[model samples]
Target: MKHVLVTGGAGFIGSHLADELLAQGYRVRVLDTLAAQVHGDGTRRPAYLHPNVELQVGDVCDKEAVVRALQGIDAVFHFAAAVGVGQSMYEIAHYTRTNNLGTAVLLEALIASPVAKLVVASSMSLYGEGLYRDGSGGVHGNCERTLAQLERDEWELRGADGGLLTPLPTPETKAPALASIYALGKYDQERMALITGRAYRMPTVALRFFNAYGPRQALSNPYTGLLAIFASRLLNDSPPRIFEDGLQQRDFVSVYDVVRCCRLALESPAADGEVFNVGSGQPLTVRDIALRLAQVMGKPHIEPEITQKYRVGDIRHCYADITKARKRLGFEPRVKLDDGMAELAAWLKDQAAVDRVAQASAELSARGLTV
Candidate 1:
């Protein structure tokens, strides 16, 4: 039997991935710090994690911890990173140390004790803005909204001729436009792992996940997935807050589908040394997602509060183009948006979530990250 180690496997996506691995007959071991931000004041083992899996409580940046985690491990899935784009802007050193430096430490250990395969979790935030098409039907990858445009409330991207641009599905070929510290860290982690894997002859795959949401999400953590944030607000009997008219589009994929893709990346020889976008391949406006979550959670009366304010690094629209994943890894997202939201709502009914959205927004506004 093959033994697989998943860094940060106690968290949302990683925990689910661990379950999938265990079901597939792989012995799973997890290395995680169980950071206070995600796991609360006390770093106790999450009850949701499979009991059969071996859990190692340690920081990935610690060389001794990483070295120990790699012992007897045949393959590795690197998922240890500090999340939250807004928090990353102010806590620069924390994100850099945990995401970038942690990956470096893990890669160095892998060099000494080479794993047969390495898969790293990447993020779609690296693409600041998704691909767009001008009115002339020309595709443009280098489109960005200026501060002046944002201040004027011109939310959409436009061509040089001042014509409005339509958002196109962003493929893996699109050049990255890193807009936040978290994104930069993710990009760095992905590149570092792939480079190290190539040099060491370890097959590596990078999965650029969009918005992954399901049960066991850190509901109290305000900086988690968008759906979880909205659910927390709804559960607290507060209106879900929408930013910048809330028409900004994003892709939300089910965690189940994401784990399936991760497994495919681990097993597929064709996925070696490649990066694939793992998302639902469908775009939904932020406002629509909020409303849908409310409806599913039996809070249709609690409408979303649309705040005209915008965050500095926010993107207008970005969804996935999953053609590469479909062809290479045979990935097909089976869960529809409605079904996923319903499942999340059902799981959330019995859970208690601390409402920290207001506090988080205040912190960002104080730092001038939100306007």
Candidate 2:
């Protein structure tokens, strides 16, 4: 059986991908530091990870660790990084060093120990406000909400004479509008892996994942994954806070679908030297999704308070146009939205998810990240 090395395999998406790989008869090895933010206070292996995965606790930025993990690996999935768009704004040096420099170190290690396939994890945050259309049937996509407009409580994008702009599906061809340090780092990682991998003759694939959520999500990391944060609050019988009138849209793909798409990229020849947006084709408003999840958890009364408050650098709307992934990787989201919500609710019932949202909000407030 072929062996695959998954960086950050102990985390949510990577762990699920590892389980998928193992089931497909591939020997899976997990190389992760198991960061305290994601996996809790201790440096212990996550119990959610499949026991069969050969766990190697290490960091991707460490050359020796990366080189050691590459040994006997036919393919590599580079998914290790400090995730969170808001936190990255203030932790500029930390995010740059971890995401950008970490990828650089991995590329260098791969030169010494080449792998057949390399799939790097990217994010949809790079798209910023997504595509938009004007009243004149003109498409003006990928425009960010200005701070001045945000201060005025003008959440939606506007055109000439304050014409309302409607959201559009963002395809892979959309020009990236990096709004935060985290998004910039993910873009850098995507480009670095592709450039270095192609130059070294290694088949590379970049998967730009939207908001991925399911089991094993880190409730502690408030910088990313709105679903996890929402779920954490609901579990604690707290109101799921909705930002910006709760009308901002996002594409929430299941981790199962994400893993399947990742597997396709790892095995398919067509996915080489290409980038694909991996997200549920369906778009839902933040308010709607939070309510849906609350209903799933039998906490319909624990409604999401529409705070009308938004964090800086947040987009008005961003959803994926998954035509490229479907055509190239045969990737399609199979998990229905209701079913995914039900699954998440069921899994979270018995788990103790510490509600860190309050602390996270306070931290952001102190940094002026939240208005």
> What digit string (tens of lDDT, one per residue) describes model 2 on residues 42-72?
8898888898999999988898998889889
For candidate 1, write residues 1-371 as lDDT tens digits. Answer: 28999999999999999999999999999999999889888889999999998999999999999999999999999999999988999999999999999999999999999989999999999999999999899999989988888887778899999999999899999999999999999999999999999998999999999999999999999999999899999999999988889999999999999999999999999999999999999999999999999998998999999888878778889999999999999999999988888899899999999999999999999999876
Residue 196 in candidate 2, Cα distance off native in Å: 0.5
Predicted structure with the largest TM-score when compared to the true one: 1
RMSD of 2: 1.1
lDDT for model 1, on a 0 to 1 scale?
A: 0.94
Clashing pairs in 2: 132-141
Candidate 1 least-lDDT 10 residues: 146-155
Cα-based TM-score, every candidate: 0.99, 0.98
- Candidate closest to the true structure, highest lDDT: 1
